[model samples]
Target: MSWIVDRIRPREAPSFSRPLALLVAGALFLENLDGTVLQTAAPAVAQEFEVAPEGVSPAIVGYLLAVAVAIPVAGWVAERFGTRRTFLVSVAGFTAASVACALAPNLLWLCAFRIVQGVAGAMMIPVGRIAVLRSVRPTDLLAAMAYLTWPSLIAPVIAPFLGGVITDVLGWRWIFVLNVPIGMALAVGGALLVPRAEHRIRTPLDRWGYLLTAGTVVCLTGGVELLRDGRPWLVATLLLLSVTLAAAAAHGMTRREHPLFVPEVLRIRTFRAGNLSGSVYRLVITGAPFLFVLLFQAGFGWSAAAAGAMVTAVFAGNLGIKPLTTPIIRLLGFRRTLVWSIVAGGASLLAFAGVHASTPVPAIAVLLVFSGAVRSIGFSAYNTVMFADVPRDLLPAANGLSATLQQVGTALGVAAAAAAAGLGTGIAGPEAVELGYRLAFVPLAGLLVIPLVGALRLPAAAGGHATARR
Candidate 1:
């Protein structure tokens, strides 16, 4: 125990970096919050718009697709426009789009505005990350990241409850309305707090790479959305098309002299292992909230506020465990921590499978809290360990790859959850959406079991080299 403490002692805190960190984090909170809040409110939006609850997923999927489409060009845009300019534009654009989203007249109009909001959101986070990386000395990078981590991580925790409250009281549109003031404040403060960078990378934009990658994500997410439309042939066609495009994109990256992503980054065994596994794990981590929110409301006869209150317990578990994350990873090591986390997450999803109309609200909340705790450990561990094993020179490309995959996983998780619910709906008959909702967890649990296999494949000391550096 003593040796573990010595192995990962805390570094000195940075001077006067709190405001900048919080500013960057606040933007991320808006981005992350908007997506999860919509999940809790999706059912209400469905009722108002006169569509199936699952039908609202296009707005969710549309936003994610926009993020995936824009991310490949984000670095180039930041470089050409400058970080401060790009960041300010992103905040303003996202705020303006929020206004459009709140006033959308129909589902089609809402999805269109959501796509615009997602494009701005795609730019917001990476640029904010660049600000923190440049502001701190190398010694303080880890500490600075801790500050950014809090707001981004906690947003999902609070959004379900917050969204429930807003949707119940003011209606779902107000969720978008509220972001207006927050974004306006952040855009103004960001100019004052974030340091201006003199040097910018004059990197050329990779147009072909962007097109292929964007095509792949769009096809995939769109395909997931189509499954609920009762068009199996179209869904199958789009899915197959997505696979082909993905393979072509990978092949193109290998052949290009200046690829969007460097080919060699995947050769690093630990980074590869972590990225691949983390995507599968994230599918569950991200999907469960969207899936469970609907299950509680549309299926179980719980009020939106009550469902949100239950989900709030997960947020408590997340905050309760935050201070312990670094020490626990240091103590158990990445491999052990990850394995145990996968086990815990799997058990949590399985617990959800056992819920029925008679399940106690208190009992469900307890499971959610426990599930959230295990998931927080897994999310923290998976996100950190990728960098631990990546070569220093390859850090940027590796992180880009990780971020892209995680984005896809996050989008796909919602799609998959909705599709699974649809399947259960079909099988249980049109009137049995609750039964369908109950059956949805079975597939999510199965998907989660996959990453455990990835965990076992790691060497015992995987990522220890980087962990030992501090």
Candidate 2:
């Protein structure tokens, strides 16, 4: 065991070329944090605005729809405008939206501002990724991805707690108010850190491709949101529409000379594993926090803060395991690291299914920490390898596609968790609420099989270049 650690240990510290990756990670944190924070603030916002809590759903759903609709065209926007300029504008726009949200006089006004925020957020992440991919050397790709991965890991876990604190002490509007300074700081950092691309691609925008792809995203995400509201007919119609558009979009990509995405990029086996199968991994991973938070509160009769505190254990694990993640990947290679992480992550979920009110707090925390750690490793590996073999020319399209799929995966995760939890409750009966929540983990763990199978099939040398194993 000691030899194993020693072997994976870095001989010297890893270094990044600039703070650009960190800036991008900050942007990702803000985007993720804003979405989750609103979940906590909904009731308060509704009260202040004199509406039903569900009335606030429009603001949330509107933002998500805007993000989904805009994501498919992010690459084109970056190319047409330029990466640095687009990123700066995105940050500025998001900040201004935040201000508008803070000052919104009514639900309608808040929804409008949130839509603006969504459009900016849609542009912020993928463009930042484009900047990073274009500038970072292949040797530093893993480290750069590591920087970008933490925000996604940490932000969602902490937001519920942080949002509750802010809403309780200061009020819900402060949630948006706080983004002003962070946004300003990120804009400054991006300007100083992110390099201008030496060249830009000026290909004509694939208008048809954009419409089909964007339609697919909107219908898929909006349908899922509609499901939670119990609008079965609307959800069904949107699901069918989404499927039709997706099939058309696939055909367009392969048939068109210049499609929104180059179909050939999927032929790169590593990228395929990360982009396609990795989404399955993300869906299960993203859903866990949602389940755990609800389980601790509704199932165990714990307070909201207490439930949130348990998630903080997972957050702690994400950061605690970060320094070792790259070394582990370097030592074992992406395939082995990913395989082990998936298996370990599944085992952690199974462990979660066994936890009950009588279980020791320390035991639950340790299990959560382990879950968070393996998830971190798996995510970094997937993100790095997704672009491992993509040609420099295809980076923009590849980044846009990956970003779009990732967003869809994230939206589906919470929905999946909700659906699974509902099924578990039905099976267990209302009298066994705790068991119902515990049962939710069973299916989520089972979903891991999809990615595990994908990992098992990966070539031993997958993502080798990122780790300098070539």
Candidate 3:
């Protein structure tokens, strides 16, 4: 009877493999599409609401905060509900939230809707990833992950352009409205295609741990906002509060029988080093685009469409490097590729500080493209290496922790860049805008050094197949 039950389980029986890839890829594309599609629309939204651009920024911040708060809870939700149910719910929720965002009337309403959208979106990619991992064979895993990675990496490159076109032609609201069909399609496909998995052991939800973690993330993110707003005292106070909350949460979680984040996962040396390195690496890489937008629009006095178009160079570079990534990793191995890519990426960013109005557009485009390509190589290598040592049983916990940390790093990077740009403008006046951008790159370059040190701790053959313990 037990054997029959095992044989009858609804494991993803391999069928229509190509369609399976498309379904997963489509889900990933929509997930990334929403992530970046709003950036270019920010200015338009501000104008519509008759508020300052800075005031409108809360839409972005609020979304990010929601994602950060929701990520850790995903593992528990997935465990309680089966993967199929979770994916369907996540996609459906995101679709509904997207409609709410499209119809929002005022800035306040829009911000509120965006938070809902964030909550819904927070589950899409991670749960989708879990589904893919469970469904695909190990040999096919790399290809599946690569397929997902392309959309995510490419979204930023095309987002500004897409957002600008939509806003300029149809209106800013369409950016959110556009997600309606895409989201609906993904939800239906996920329901139909994703296999149901049996819940082997049900772990009780760590409600207290969830609250403490949520509080810590909110406080820390708020502190970053305070610092950007130039409220030094408030920043300090909030930072202290965040520290206290985080410590308290850590203490409490350690005592729990089923902690939200497993302490044992952190004990793995490679996972720890990979996560730490990846977080810092993302700070500079992720934040650089926000700074560049300001540099092009506010400093160089480029129109939104033109500024958005400039990023195509970066996108082109990203695409050009994709075919080469696996081969390069296979050749140089993981550690070497990651290290050199970081150094190369930092240098490219640092070089951007020298760009000026007198600089030819083509020259600038080349530099941007090169930077994008190098970054793609580095990030993929780092992300892949992080999971190499992670055991199968602990994947859920590791994914949650890594995802949360990455979001935190992204928020910090954006805030830090904004604060630095503000300071640069204050001291130099209008002329200082370019210099502010330049100065911002310096520290971002310095951030790469931290990860480089961490990379040193990884084995020389870290990225090779032999290094995978599973």
Candidate 4:
């Protein structure tokens, strides 16, 4: 009778908040899309403001910095204000900021408005994840996480090409303008779909903990951004300070009765694996699109549109593999699945390094498609398994900390890629530009070693609760 009940339970549909999950995914798409969409539009924006193209850097940096500052307090804000209210206000704020960005008459105003958008974004992402974590049953977690992971994967891959097309046809301002309707729809969806906070906690905000963590994020993110600018001394100094602050924050959080994020969350092996090794893995995949563009256009001398069109193979691969990711995870479990994904994904990078201008387009497309599929699978596993063992009470802290580390990974990825490529070029000298581009993938592939080691160390039965394996 017990065996029969267990068997029947596996076939029962897992009840979770699907509409809320979809709403959060859409909001995530908006946040991630905004971060990269403006990259290709910088020149057009500069022309309108009558400044050097590089002058637009402040607008971008300001937005990112504001996000870094706000993420630390996201969990507290949702608890204080209620998730449904916070989510609605965040969407509405972000949408209004977009309108302001579109109407900015100068670079100064644009930077200010972008900062507004960033603050809202910081609130939206972590809080939305908290909502999902609280609502999802263990059985439904993998599917819910798959929905959340898609925006992060899809947005960065398509943003460059989408930005180029939008700039060419609808104009650069339209980038922000288009978000208006989407924001309105999301706002309405949240009001209807998101459950009101079950209860609110009146925990006192930890001022010192917030400062320490925020400082660490600022230093780390700012240091990485400086790498791309060739400011080695400043980058080193900031990164050192970042490390110091991080240590201080960790030590202090453990002692505090009401810390910003409980340090004990990291004691969970699955959570720690996802944050430590998982972050390094994210750094590599995030950088791949940037490297691909440089290889296609700068190395091979292809046209911009041609390069972008070719890159769409990667996007197609990501989408094509989406439906299969969960089933694959269930079959192999997280440990074996992560190991294979990293190995295959790293091999794809090496294969990319060997490509030349004469390589068949079909060959390049197939390689990219394979890489994208593996990348998607690995990411979904890390995202889901990390939360598998976290207690319901700790979900908020875990989500907040995970979201913060993710931002660090994202902030460093492009800079690390650019720096690696630059080093490669210097070694090859001025005459062998293409060889330098090819050598860039060597180190990028090497970044996989950290995660590979971590994945192998994971217990074979790790994350069994989420996977439904015993």
All candidates: CA RMSD in angstroms? 3.2, 3.4, 5.9, 2.2
| Native-referenced Cα lDDT, model 1 | 0.79
Against the reference, the lDDT scores of all candidates come to: 0.79, 0.86, 0.77, 0.88
- The candidates, ranked best first by lDDT, are 4, 2, 1, 3
Task: Give the lDDT of residue 360 in candidate 2.
Answer: 94
Candidate 2 residue-wise lDDT, 175-241, digit = tens: 9999999999999998888776557778888899999988888888778666656678998999999
Candidate with best TM-score: 4
Clashing pairs in 4: none
TM per prediction: 0.90, 0.93, 0.91, 0.95
Better of 3 and 4 by TM-score: 4
lDDT of residue 145 for candidate 4? 95
lDDT of 3 by residue, 351-427 (tens): 97788877999998999899989988887776666666677788888877877777677667677677767766776
Encode model 1's per-residue lDDT on 437-464: one tens digit a residue.
8888888888876788888888888777
The lDDT leader among the candidates is 4
RMSD, candidate 4, Å? 2.2
Worst 10 residues of 3 by lDDT: 134-143
lDDT for 151 (candidate 4): 92
After the best TM-score superposition of candidate 3, give how far the Cα of residue 292 lies from its true spot, in angstroms.
Answer: 1.5
Error of 1 at 211 (Å): 0.2
Off by over 4 Å in 1: 1-18, 42-56, 134-145, 150-152, 427-435
